[model samples]
Target: MKGEPRLAELIASLSLATDLGLGLPQEHVLRQTVIAMRLAEAAGLDHAAQADTFYVSLLAWVGCIADSHELSRWFGDDRQIRADSYQVDKVGLPMMRLMLTHVGADAPPLRRITTIGRFLTGGFRDAVDGFVAHCQTTGDVADRLGMNARVKVALSQAFERWDGKGVPGTAGGEQIEAVMRVVQIADDAEVFCSTGGPDAAGVMLRSRRGSEFDPALVATCLAHSERIFSGLHEVDAWSLVIEACPDLDRPVRLAELDQMLEIFADYADLKSPWYLGHSRAVSALADAAAVEMSCSAADRALVRRAGLVHRLGATGVSTSIWNKPGRLSAAEQERVRQVPYFTERILSRQPTLAGIGSIAGMAFERSDGTGYPRGLRAAAIPVPARILAAAAAYQDLAEERPTRPALPFPQRRAALLADVDAGRLDAAAARAVLAAAGHAVGRRTRLVAGLTAREAEVLELLVRGLANKQIAARLSVTPRTVATHIEHVFTKTGVSTRGAAAMFALRHGLVDAGGTSAERPM
Candidate 1:
């Protein structure tokens, strides 16, 4: 965290998020990478091949994010499907049954039936396409991170199997990349061994030899299964993986670190379509707000970095919950609340990212003692954290969600102010966010329909069907003040009922059809 951060530290930290997405135990990827390294050495792979194996093992499932929305549409929980996928060779009827069984598993009976029917007709083809996208996306990610061509090539072969039954089904037998073959064994070996011990791991490898695994590599792994897995449970996988980084020139300079964090943001946002650019939006807003608030350069960097990775924890939750249209059950809400906790845990694994994680974990912490995970109060939160919280709150409103359409620019500002009034946000932080978002703050700006700025704000919320008290809470004003504003808006707009007021607002183009005015953060 003090000097330049090494690439190993960053990738190892990212593996934690990968583990959550895979629904495997926390160090599953690290352990799999360890197994891969051992398998590489035992199989007499060259130094370069061994390195590729290590990287491919870590990144094997990273592409799962690219099609998670589709996965959730086809399968009830993408993570659960991924976790259970290890139970069998995903080819032929086994693959078909897996899809058939899980399609809309959590939905109502009628919906599930319809989903299964649709999947049988053409959805299966779409799922296969998803796999192709996954392969392309994983390769692109490796290429973007400056990985060598061997690493990217090997990763692109991720879904290939020994029997030519994997997605795309184009590569089979020895046609599959050797490095990928080694990782295939290590990946399943880690899962089986962890769940069933070394013998179970051996059984899986031998059983799938020449079908799901490379026959020669499986034989090698089976020969020394005990030696390969020895101390796996006892050793620190994180430390071991870090030590296994192949390059001596691993430290990433500041600019490189920024790019890596942005990748992290994209990785998290890719979990669901609704969140495609949420993290970057938050990061940009927070950085701009920090400048507006006159924060130190260090604080600005910290807050911005924190914003970029704030939703890393979203990987731990199922896309079903994230993409749900209706209200969440209490249990679902509890799981959602734990997202920031998971984000902190994932980032805290690497020293370079730990500080950012600490601030990012407080994304949901309220000013008054009303947030989640740890619920720290206003005094407990630092200035950077306050700014980050406010930025995240505002940006979230700017994005459309399954439950509601994107709030117009004016309503977003009003919502921030309401949070400030409710003691859930720092007033200055909220004001800075407003200003950074292109709003003119602390000024009596005139508006449409001969309405004052305050009346316009009140009118926007009212058009959205908010009650007077709700509007007051959003604007941080009293219900009486809200009533007064509404009355003035009615007098100015010549409308008495909420319906008429809404029609007028729409007619006047007060509602912004577009999302936010700020450019997306680069």
Candidate 2:
């Protein structure tokens, strides 16, 4: 609703921490952007190009996580691969060595053999080429968001090298956009500084001059290295970078901003062939379900918006887990759970986006309080969140995961309904969800003591161990209402205690055994 351009808003959002599986501080991206912008100014670029360079620098590595699946698929841990990527200069030799070493690092022999065979069959080649596609896709998103053509062009060539060894390999030196050159140096400079401070970054520029980086720009960075980097450690990177955004010739509006974010989300999802259209699918599904459930238009829009960014937290999880063909360990599962939280952290910055963030943050939460990062009980959750969570779950089920095939319609329906019966989802909301997912709801016998849809839901939660207060919070009802629902459930189900209710629900297709049906002890 704010008058700010969505492009600016996105930049503000992306300027948050890298979330690269390391517990690094937030604003890592913003700090890098600041360094890149200052380096551009030092390089004597014109005001227009500098502005273009500013955004390019901020978003240059925004797509870094796109190839994470591939990296993790071939290598054991995607974050380690990225950490190592920063240390290498030439792409080919280092990559070959890294690939050979990591081929079967943590996998079984057969799995490793399969990965190696695939890599030899051009999988590695495609993975490398993905970098270029990432740039093009990123630039395309910027173009769609109404950014100037110069910025788009600069972003498109962001991965190009001076020696013509980069993706697309078409532009170099003067042919490459000036912003691209500035951003390239800025990108490496941040890594070097993080490794060895400003002096190391300067050395890296000097070392790569005329090969990986523009010699002139490197010299410019070297000349003003001290002044450009002065006090970089002092100011908050996000605020400084945001304040330094070259004021656009014209202010951007909210609609334009949303379009821009959609583009970015789409591009981010395109990093891997598997993720090609996942974000758009989730967004559409979430929005459709929200409308089908008769949610307010504003709430519907919020769900759609949250869907676009629900996977932004995917940046924090290692791509290895995302693309692995085997099961994830407990540690890996915990890492995966952090993604929704990461999305929340990024969106929570802008107050206007608070509702969107709140929904996005709970995309992984279940009504039974079994979802990660927070095991919120039924009454503690929100309806919008419940819908978002269900939509996301259904979408993921429809997609191919690392360790499983896409769920068939019948299986997907049964699984979803099981969650509904298990107190992990709202019954009315689940019915709406099933309909949205194209499932027919024929007349069937009541599953739990002839409980109505709402009553079944209350019973499911009661079995799950949610206290009246927590149930009220999740259902957006008062504790007294929840108590009344519980009393009715007891009378109807002939249950005397929560334990008995849980047994009856579980036995009668009302709950799952994942302990997800039961709320954790308060």
Candidate 3:
């Protein structure tokens, strides 16, 4: 066992994806934690309050991904929508303006009109009130992570208002946790300050003081602006956040780690309806091929997890690109290229999760170096990466995408081999993945004993114990033809018995070695 992962590393990894989900720059959430914890200290919070604030800051948008499919449906790009969100309060006018601008964006004229109609009727209502769902989802992640009840409760209350104007409309003022107020204020401050200066962050905080924020907590944060923001400009966001985690040193149970990763896989798949089962499918194929290729147990685990999370950066890009039916614009393609690099960067931020990032980042790279994010070529990519890439490619061809239908088995095999022959995929790795995907590769396609192609086909069925009548049916030939071919097969092989013919077929590699035997010749 590699022992359990630290609580801090786990949270740091999840928060990296959460940052992308919010459409904020990487480390946005981590930086918020830094600011929030500092605000907690400056406000003279006790140890318990500081701890509560830490959990809330890292997990505030933990459920932000729950409504990604919905966001992408109404607005084209969920990430862009989230980024624009921080610019305006989700109140009357600014919210309506944003909604009006994006209702069925990029859709055809008729589709746009229909989408607008749905929005006016009841769709907009479901969206505006999704806060309760987000809260509950985040709370679920917290509970699965074995967090305390206080952390779960604070998370669910995240969208509530101080004056009772927020979602759920149930909690107000002190009904929401005091620590949550500090974290919420610091969250926006980090985003607002990045574009504006500390002065701008402070101004933004003051603007929302009473109704959206706690007046006292905001006042304390403003009072200690110098100390709170001190050295922040010099520190690395991820390192500072990980180091500051009060629970960073404790190791999580192995089973807990697996469940957490499964949750992340499910979350990644939710980014678009097109991606519904992609991460899990890729993970399963990669894991199986890793075992076939004899990766070390640790590397096997890492490869599987990396496959699950290799698309973490996908959330950073707009779903508009993902859902586009036509060709992408040059600028849009560039955004797509950044996904693997983004995944690598996010995973690298966590000290313990860094190795997995290196492996996951190469999932899209090709042997010919024509792949995106980083055009790693040939041996420049590791074996595990090659396997992951091949596994992902196999699943990609076999699965349907918005832009194309799923390739049939024959086409899938041909596509894979073509990539290998073109020097764009690792030949051995592709073979392993293809075989694992149930696309058998037959090694003996030659005419053994002068058997014709038709005869070879008949011989295979005979060896498998098919009766002459069944063989005739399978080959779509008369029983006389089947019997005549069977006699030719016996005379050519110098064998009269089915058992002897079966032995010959088995000896000639008629059965599966790895891939499906109905495989195309390489």
Candidate 4:
């Protein structure tokens, strides 16, 4: 634990969060990765193909985060949709039926009918668009993490099928990357095997062979089915994947560690469009507030890392709940409160990240024991965790939600102070966070990608899920003018979709991570 952590630990641990997001049991990805590796070995693939298969297996469905917002709109619970998707081949009428079954599942009768009508019109096209978004976002994240080109390319084809039925439908049969083919079988195999045993897994694999799965790989799986799944249920998938890390157990340096953590932050935030940049903003605010509080350098860094991952568990909850425009019912609120616990469980399995996980898990704990998951009182809450709680609160207030617009600085500040009065947040921590936000420093002066100030502003609102008319109204411009600005933004940034543009803004820090200073509040 004292030594630098290996890259495998980081990725393997993050895969746990991916499982939660996909509504699978923890270690589902790890189990699938192990299975994929076994299948790759059994197929007599070369070392390069084997290595690519290893990572592609772990990261295959991670792109699911990219289109969760759209999924939630079409299907009430994105996770449930994914969990159920394993039972069917996601192409043609079967795929369309699965989606229609879940459309507006939790909405009121009128809203549900309206949503169904919308889906009947153009929703399937939007669904295909989501797959495209997933591929690009996954490739971008792989590129940023310094994954090899083969790995990135394999990830880009994650949505493609052997039958040419996948989104983008650019590749089929042998044209699809072999590594992706391996993962396709292993991914669903793990689910079927886990639920109904290896016999069921074998049946499912053979059924989709040459269509959803590569025939050769499926044949290999059937030949070595017993060996491929041997001890899959008995062994600890996390430990197996970490020890068998194809990267030779290489450790990530401190700088690389921070960069990868930032990638995880972006991935977690991508769970919903409304959450775009939320983790980054909270991280920036927490780091700055820790400085204002006179914390030690190590503590400052710890809080910042914690802030970035504090919402990792947020993936466990459905966007239908997170995106709710009105007050939550008692049952819904209870489920949301478990987010921090999920975060802690995801990170705690990785030895080096466990400490950071503990701090992040306390992001919702209140000073007076009113907050959730643990509800520790003031004396038990450490200073850094307290600052994290306050930083997260402040950033949330500053961000636009479906229920309300971004709070003005004065109102946001007053809200924080009011939390202090209500004994929910630390008084000192709230003051430090307010001061840090009011006097935010070291923002990038020159915009990258040649975006004008207004273009950057439009990009921010666009990422926040605002329509052209809403953005125009907010900026006091016509919808056509906003459209022009958006087109310019897309051209300059080299991205054609709002999801990709949001990634650009977040990666380049063009959008405000926190509030701007109108006054130097103490």
Candidate 5:
């Protein structure tokens, strides 16, 4: 793991995404990480140990999205529910009160009934299970990335409280890790500061001192409250926080990048159970489809990258809408539409990720003028965007949603083709997506260049908007191998720019069409 991308950098980027998902200002998570690191240093931890603390703080809520489906199921708006989590201690009166207030608070009569029924049927058990799962899942990802065992253990116990009333209910001073304790306080403090300023943040921390937070840390935070938060409001939070990164000397290698992306993608997917593994599946299917479509190597690569993260916006929607068992109300639908836009908002902040953002931002846009957020018709959308959009839509349709069963292969293909015929999806792009999905068209066999199944997997991720590093992790290969695959793909596809390569895939039937089918032969 030594030449890998500093865990801090990836964590920082992830924090930014988490902020967007929560509808907060960028770097909210990063700032908390910074504060946590400083607190760790202040607590006399060594540099190597501080690195562990850094990651733990940034990733404390990595599993926050995991239970979003459940949260939305009970509360309606998952993000709002999470945001409110910051306001209440997850114990006793505060916790119970918050739950009662938020449950079905803004839902319609029908939704309210459903929510009540779910709670009685098993929502309480489900919520607790979801929280425990989030901790374990996040800890597992940290372990997969080669993080310190102690950190992983701490992440697993992140929801534990000193009073033994948290998720796992294993209370004790020793049960809570030193880093987790500091980071927890820091995380809550940062949220309060961002929303209500230093005074409010201070008051919140003071109020929860012995119950939700450590008393000693609370005393320290209150003592230096002004100094800790001074000028925080004036800072360009993203830069201020990221620039303060605990300066590791090496850049992230491709393999490390892949691991981080996979972890983050999984975390993002947790926002709704319906979306679990959706990004990874889309990336794989899209890459195969790209190769089948004869897309240039660069475009195939970009499509893969886009596919890995296309649903970043889904986090912003309330779990209520996402998990509803029936059609969305007009307002709920509108909120759902804003998800793609939110994905772009988060991605736009990082220059390295801008390309992926651009493609993902158009996930909901239709070929015809009927799509939402910004209903740009055909020709108005970029070709790369068109391909990515088609893959995402087809993938979503093929999956079982709360309101609908999974579409059968024939029905799905017909529906997809209807979009093409209606001018809502580019015919060539739709064909490529279908091919990638393992569907056959009249007399046309899917195509693939000199690429292994693994290499094609890598190629599709690239097109979906993952970086070289991200591709390596998802495919379980070395960064160098991912780069080599990219180079080979470029040579075979005859294109250089990512956008151009993506266009080529759409035109050639290389993307997977969201059903079970034999992948193209290497």
Candidate 6:
């Protein structure tokens, strides 16, 4: 584990994409992280407080994607609204004005009026709760990544204002954590300076000194003046922040890998309530289908992890498109297509996770080569990749979408077969995935040559590309036990080596499960 990557590295890799979701350039979060460090020093925050400030600044806005679906539901261009919002203080009348301007800017008159009517009802309450959700979810991610207790608690209060006017305000003034106060200024200051230079940033912070920001911290930042505000444009933002990461970026426990991947799954699904369990469901099906296809244990886990993070790019796409009630224009359709590519680019930055990203990026490829991002042909795709693509399509077809209701399972199942017939999915991969979906599942009901029914099962898994060790793991047996079974299978079936045994099984129809239609999808 000496060269293994740390969890912070994973979080840092996603910092750029988080900025894109906020409608800022990739380095927005990184620059703010550096600025927060400077503010922490000037405020005389202790070592412990400084470390908390580092992560709090980097992740403050990373959870912005969680409200995208709801935000787009209430505002046509959620991304643009957020981008404009950074230009003003989010407290009191300015926040109300911002909401009024964006609520129905592009909607029809009737729709706009109805939106206002709903806003008067309970929609106002929901909007305030969205900020609470942001703070809660961000803390959840930090917790999942094993951050310190102080970081998690301060993060949960990130939106609490000095004047106690913020979401779920439980404390204010000095009671508000210093790290949150420092980050609030750093977060807004970066936006003003990057877009309007230091003078505009200075003026903006000065105006909100006590109401929206801690006055002392704001003064400290302004005092540093040239040291903190200058050269932001000249420095290498990404490398600087990575180097400045808190000293807690140590190697993760191997057992924590799935938990880390689950963090990605949770973060991606947070884009909308509609995506509630979308990634987890797909990951489960893909894992089961990998087992059905006898994919190696390593490959099975990899494919499942791919299913979880395949939608990482969904962060960059607006919820306007994801929650649209009707068809999309060509331009909108093109935007939806880049999601997987974004996922790949983000994951590829961390070398340890590059394999998962490689496979996850192909979750939409077609056998006929009509998929977006890359039109990979059938033979060009691997079995695990093909299973993932098929599984995701199946699940999406069975789930509700913005433009349509959930298709009946019969109809969804028919659509999957149609894709196989139309060359969009491989036949064997389709059947195996269908079996995983409970289409026609059963062990070999008959013997092959002189082999027992169970011996035939082992041979089928072998032919489908499992190694002895993987097969043993899947069966909960030792490799030596599997070796004994394989020898008996070879002698009984008049075959040696895995390929020949597989051919014999296929030729004899033992691997195809001729006895039962229950799970024989083909």
C-alpha lDDT of all candidate models, in order:
0.81, 0.68, 0.75, 0.84, 0.69, 0.76
Off by over 4 Å in 6: 439-522
TM-score of each: 0.84, 0.75, 0.79, 0.93, 0.76, 0.79
Off by over 4 Å in 1: 439-522
The best-first sequence of candidates by lDDT reads 4, 1, 6, 3, 5, 2
Tens digit of lDDT per residue, candidate 6, span 1-522? 753567676777667668767877767888898889988988899988988898888788776765565577678777787788887788778887888778877889999988978875866675776676566557556766778888877887778888888878898898888998999999999999998898889999999989889999989999996788879989987677767777777776655776677667756655644454577678878898888888998889889989988888887778777767678999899988998888887787567678888889999999999986899998888888898999889878756665666667678779999999999998887777778877534443567578886677677666443567877777788999888888899889765544344334433446431121121100
**Candidate 1 collision pairs:** 418-474
Which stretches of model 4 miss by more than 4 angstroms?
441-446, 472-488, 513-522
**Residue 198, candidate 2: C-alpha displacement in angstroms:** 1.5
Please name the candidate that would achieve the greatest TM-score relative to the true structure: 4
What's the ranking of the predictions by TM-score, best on top? 4, 1, 6, 3, 5, 2
lDDT for predicted candidate 4 compared with the true structure = 0.84
Q: 151-270 in candidate 5: lDDT tens per residue?
A: 787787788876667878776565688888888888888888887898898899888888788888778877777666777767676665566665442466653454456555555665
Residue-level lDDT for 207 in candidate 3: 82
Q: lDDT for model 1, on a 0 to 1 scale?
A: 0.81
Of the candidates numbered 1 and 5, which has the greater TM-score value? Answer: 1
lDDT of 3 by residue, 72-134 (tens): 668877777778877665666777788877888878999999999988897677676556557
Residue pairs in clash, model 4: none
Q: Give me candidate 5's TM-score against the actual structure.
A: 0.76
lDDT of 1 by residue, 1-522 (tens): 366778777877888999998889998999999999998998899887887787788887777766677678789688998888889887878878978888888779999999899999988886787677677667656756788888888887889999998867889989889999999899999998898899999988888998899899988998877779998999999888888788533678877777788778877876765666578778888999999999999999999999999999999999878888889999989999999999999988666688889999999999898998898999999999999999999988887677887788889988999999999999999999999998523333336868876787777676543567777777788999998888898788765544345435433445332222322111
Residue 85, candidate 4: how far off, in angstroms? Answer: 1.1
Q: Number of the top candidate by lDDT?
A: 4
lDDT of 2 by residue, 1-522 (tens): 453444555666765534343224466667677877888777777888778877777666665554454455567676676666666675688767766766767778888888788788876775665575456445544545567777777777867889788777888778998788877877777777876889898877877899888898888888888877777768877667667778773455655545655654554453333454466667767777887899998788878888777777776766556655667789888888888888788877666555677888888888888886798977987887788788878777776554566778888889888988899887766676778878423333256566777777777566444567877777788998888888888788765444345434533555422212233222
